[model samples]
Target: MARMATHMITGAGSGIGAAVARRLHERGDELVLLARDAGRAKELAGAFPGARTLVGDLANPDRLSWAFSHQPLPDRIDSLVHSAGVVDLGPVGELTTRAWRGQLEVNLIAPAELTRLFLPQLRTARGHVVFVNSGAGLNAHAEWSAYAASKHGLKALADSLRAEEHGNGVRVTSVYPGRTASPMQAKVHSQEGKEYDASRWIDPESVATAILASIDLPRDAEVNDLTVRPGH
Candidate 1:
């Protein structure tokens, strides 16, 4: 019998991450969720019984190596899904350095660090790496400089990793979803002073399906990038 696949996921608390975790859990795959602290790790553990949780704050990417060193990591990781992110919208002149740093650390640097730490397992398992990036990663709009810049960096990271890991039998994919109807969307709406409407955007489950498709593909082929936009 084939061994069960193990996936290490970030942002499993809500949104697309939650949807992805739910699907994987339901399908009997193993999950390792990344949490910012012990409390959050406990919460995720409760949410997904039988799933493991790792406490590593994405806000401080520099600390992840040390953090993981202190914790037990999975010996086999079939996939690493980076779905956690932070967004603070502001014009270039108005955005604070803290805001820029926060987004960059969470959306860009942390994923890179996490991937670096897990490359050995990934290469051994011939695993996949999925990056949940935003449409902003492809295009920057007004008042979205910092967030977009971070996402754009994420795109470059994914692209470069894909190139570098191909020889190792590891696959890299980036999913660029247009504004999804999630808490993040609500927050973005609030920041824009616009009334929130969840119905108009793509569903998190849809994005999850796309992500799973990439992960489940035959080893002979790989999905390099997937772009999902709202139907409406």
Candidate 2:
């Protein structure tokens, strides 16, 4: 029998990450979820029994290496999925440096650091890395300056990693989903002062399907980028 695949995921507490975790858990795969604290770690452990949790605050990317040195990392990881992100909307003229730093830390730098830390295990397993970027990664709107910049940087990271890791048998994919119905979306709507309507957007599960498809493809082929838009 083929060995069960293991996936390490961030942002599995809600949204697309939760959907992906549920699907993988149901399929009898091993999961390692990243949490910001012991309490969040406990919550993830409870949510997905038998899955492991690692505590490392994404807000402090510089400390992840130090944090992981003190924790037990999975011996093998078939995929490392980056689905955690934060967004605050404001015009460039009004946005604070703190706001810019917050989004950059969580959305861009955290994923990059996590990938660097896990590259050894990932290369050993010939694993895949999936970045759950946003449509803003492709286009920056008025108030989305900071968030978009981070995601745009994420795209460059994925692209560069793919080029560098291809010979190592490590696949890199970026999934750009447009306005998914997630807590992040709700928060974005709140910031925009718009009424929240979950039904109008793509479902988290739909995006999860795209992510899993990229991960599950045969070793002979790889998906470089995937874009999911609301069907309605």
Candidate 3:
């Protein structure tokens, strides 16, 4: 039997991250889940025996440092799936400094730091780095300036990593998923004062399945970017 590879996923407590965790677990992959909410993370771990859970808020610099430093490692981690993110909706004129800063910290800076921490292992394993970006990462939509800016930053970060790490055999993939049916989307819908329409959004499970397919690609092939949107 082939050795089961380990993957670390941030934001595994809910939404797309949670869905990916479940899918990986079902497929018998070793998992390390990092979620800010200790209680929720622990609860999720109960369903996946042998899976590891780390509690750290992605926005907290101290926690970010602690989470990476404290974790035990194998010679290499097969992949690091960056699924944690925050969404803020507003026109550029209405965007607050705090909101803008918070979004950038979690969406951009945290992932970069985590990637840096895992770079050596990733290089050793020739592993893949998957970023769960937003449709906003591709273009700015009305009333989503802050969120779009942060995701745009994330897209650039992924692009740069792919170029810089190509020689080391590391593959970087950015998944731009549009309006997935998730708690974050529900919150955005509430903010817009519109009826939450689950039917109009892509399901998190479907995105998780696609992510799995990306990872399963033959070593000779690389999927640099994947954009998933609602069919309707």
Candidate 4:
């Protein structure tokens, strides 16, 4: 089946990535879904029928490189969404070096490496790069120091890429969504010693819609950043 558009999404096994996959599939786009767990990625892909699934730990550069080397990239991708991330929460005083390094590797370094790998394809199509960030990227949240630091670093990555890639016709957009309802949020709530309340969080579907809006922009226009928060 020749599709009108093709998009690649990281973290497609669940949460926002899975939502984006379904939404893109609904829009008649072909997909290449990447997930850390092979079984989970395949199960998610099954829902979409034709979506290709690849399993690679984005935190490991060598492994990620090897995985991409084996799996064929689309000749021209319409969009690349970096939604895979790990969050480690602790006060700065109690944060261990190992914990900090782990978050940085998965949240910051890995995404950079993956983005670099896709540059050639993205440039070929003048495609869009979307980084799914958090409000933590915009400001510090108490006890979320390590996670905030990683997100801040991610925001920097997006800024630098946008300025550098713009000349190549590759548009970059960072989405800072506040308190989205997901298993991750449930974990955060546990750390905060608060009961998880799904109603207070923004739906992942809304963030996925925002990504599509950025991709839908005319060639002459680009959405540099999109920030969404629940009305709480």
lDDT of each: 0.96, 0.97, 0.88, 0.87
Q: Which pairs clash inside model 4?
A: none
lDDT of 4 by residue, 20-132 (tens): 98898987788988877767776867888888877778767557888878776678787999998888788888999998988898888988988988889899989999999
lDDT of 3: 0.88
> TM-score for every candidate vs. truth?
0.99, 0.99, 0.95, 0.95
Give the lDDT of residue 166 in candidate 3: 97
Candidates ranked by lDDT:
2, 1, 3, 4
In model 2, the clashing pairs are none
In model 2, what lDDT does residue 10 have? Answer: 97
Q: Write the per-residue lDDT of candidate 2 for residues 1-232, one digit (tens) a residue.
A: 9999999999999999999999999999999999999999999999999999999999999999999999988987999999999999999999999999999999999999999999999999999999999999999999999999999999999999999999999999999999999999999999999999999999999999999999999999999989999998
Please, what are the lDDT tens digits per residue for candidate 1 over residues 117-204? 9999999999999999999999999999999999999999999999999999999999999999899999999999999999999999
Residue-level error in angstroms, candidate 2, position 179: 0.3
Ranked by lDDT, the better of candidates 1 and 4 is 1
For candidate 3, write residues 1-232 as lDDT tens digits. Answer: 8888889898777789889989989889899887677686778689678898776688874467767566665567788999999887887888889999999999999999889877998998899999999999999989988889889999999999999999999989999998999899999999898999888899999999889888889999999999998888
Which lDDT value does model 1 have at 26?
A: 96
- The collision pairs in model 3 are none
Global Cα RMSD, each model: 0.6, 0.6, 1.5, 1.6
Segments in model 4 whose C-alpha atoms lie over 4 Å from true places: 1-3
